[model samples]
Target: MITARREAWTGRVLLVLLMAITILPFLSLFVTALHPSGTYPPGLSWPGEPQWGNFLKAFQAARMGELLKSSTLIVLGVVPIALVIATMAGFAIGHLRTAGRNVVFIAFVLGLTLPFEGIITPLYYQVRDMGLLNTRWAIILPLIGLFMPFSVFWMRAHFVNMPAELSESARIDGANTWQLFWRVHVPLAMPAISSLAILLFLWTWNQFLLAIVLVDDPLKRTMSGALGAFQGQWGTDIPLLCAGSLLILAPTLVIFVIFQRRFVTALLQGSLKG
Candidate 1:
């Protein structure tokens, strides 16, 4: 009983420390945001008159409504396609015994090593050539392509660990390959698939690099990209920036919080089952 109490105390301390570390930057941002817009203190004293309305100013100045709309559309567009493609590719790579499967898997693994910065120059030209430059698709396609490798590799690993006997049994019962995959394997692989979907959603939502490069039109930019523009407009408006930063961060945070339990469960179950 004494040992258990000590362990619990240790866990509580660790949790508090982690929470403090995670929240410190955000707290600092808030403290700055609450300060008077033009006369922020350098020494980090609490604001004399907390300007909570700076968030409104930041939102209006950044055209945050349009930015939010555009970002939502982009995330909505990319995530489903990425999930479907990754799921199919991962399943295929794992289940099929084709000669080039290892080669293909290796190619995907290599893709994880490729830097987006290195490919941006050529990718920009390619998008421009395809008439996708300046369009939302420019950002969407590139990000999907970039993230596919990691998604596929992870899904493949999960799928490969699933029992072959299940597929074999399905085949013995005369289930077609498609039927076996969709009806049997997919249901069994839900934990992995759910985990992947959550991850893909997070990645696509927070994507900034592709947004910066592919989207030149401010009206068509993402939340992250729009934040950059917001910074340009209200660089000195630290309070507003903080409020805006919190606003920008809120959606992803809510999403993670909502799905976090499922994410943890799915990942743990998938890994263990695999």
Candidate 2:
């Protein structure tokens, strides 16, 4: 009993230390962001007076309004279409008895192995050839394709674990494949779908490399992607830079906090089901 009690105490202490390590950087960042715009405070020292307006200054300086709009547009474009395609493909593979289904599923699984860095060069050239360079489509199209493998995999895991009797009963009721999918499976898959949407939103919002490389217009890139240019333009202003970073991070943080329960449910469900 004493040994087990000691072990539990040790674990609690270690967890507290780990939490501090994880949180300290962000705490420092928030503190630094509150410092006066032009002053570069050494280390993690708190400012004498917190400059709250630094965020507004940073927002205007970074032209964040346009960047936010662009990121929203990209997310809007990518998430819906990707979800639809992935869901259909997953349903076909998971629930249907189609020929060569294994082959098709393997093709998507193979896609998971192809990293963005591997094909980015070729992709750039292809987009250039198609006259999509420097456009939002350049980012949107590639992101959808890039997200497909994992999205399909995630949805397939959910569908495969769902009771076969669900589809079986629907078929006996004279429902067609489309009806079975839309009327039955889709409604039941809401939790997984909602989770997928949240993830896609986060991924699309945070996407940097493709946004920077594919689009030339700073206004057309994601907020995080545009941060490079923002940093270049205002690197010396440490407080301003930190403020801008916080602004860029705020939306995603807000989203995760709000939808945390759903996200956790999806992860737990997927793990148990898959």
Candidate 3:
């Protein structure tokens, strides 16, 4: 009993330490953000007066409204289409025993090995050739393609691990392939799909490289993408810059907080299946 109590106390202490370590930086950012603009306070130092209006100032100066709209459009354009394609491809690969399915799966696995840096230059030229440069499609199309490897892999893992009895029972009931997929599999896969949607939302929102590189207009780029240009313009204004950074981070933070339970459940399920 003594040993168990001691171990429990140690674990609690460790958890508290970990929480502090994780939270301190964000606390510092919030504190720094509230410092009056043009007054650079030292680390963790509180300003004489906190300027909560700095967020409004940053929002106006950065044209964050337009940036947010662009990000929403890109994310909406990417996530649903990518989810549908990845789910269908995963189902085909995982459930169907068609010839050449292994070859196709291997192709996608190879796609996972190809990094953004390796393809960015060629992608730029291709987009330019297609007259998509400086357009939202420039970012949207590539993001969908780039996201495929991981998304398909994730969905495929879920489908592959699902009990074969489920599929066998559906088949016995005279369900066609379409019915098997839409009626039987999709409903059961909701948790995994929801988890993937949250991940895709995060990735799409936080996407920086493609947004910055593909689109020339900061207003047309994602919030993070525009941050690069915003930084260049306002790097010296520490408080306002921090304020702007927090603004960009807020949506993703809200999303994670809301769906955190689903995310955790999916992760635990994936681990157990693996």
lDDT of each: 0.84, 0.92, 0.92
Pairs of residues clashing in candidate 1: 33-239
Give candidate 1's TM-score.
0.92
lDDT of 2 by residue, 173-215 (tens): 9999999999999998888999999999999999989988988
Q: Give me the overall lDDT of model 3.
A: 0.92
Model 3 lowest lDDT segment of ten: 93-102
Q: TM-score: which candidate is best? A: 2
TM-score of each: 0.92, 0.96, 0.95
Summarize candidate 1's per-residue lDDT along 68-140 as a digit string, tens digits. Answer: 8998898888888988898889988987676789999999999999998899999999999999988999988
Off by over 4 Å in 1: 1-12, 42-44
For candidate 3, lDDT tens digit of each residue in 1-274?
9999999999999999999999898898899999999878799998888899999999999998998899999899999999999999999998877789889899999999999989999999999999999999999999999999999999999898888898889999999999999999999888888999999999999999888888999988888999999999999999999999999999999999999999999989999999
- Clash counts per candidate, in order, are 1, 0, 0
Cα lDDT for residue 71, model 2?
A: 90
> What is the TM-score (0 to 1) of candidate 3?
0.95
Q: After superposition, how far is residue 199 of candidate 1 from its true place, in Å?
A: 1.5
In candidate 3, the residue pairs with backbone N, CA or C atoms under 3 Å apart (3 or more residues apart, or in different chains) clash, namely: none
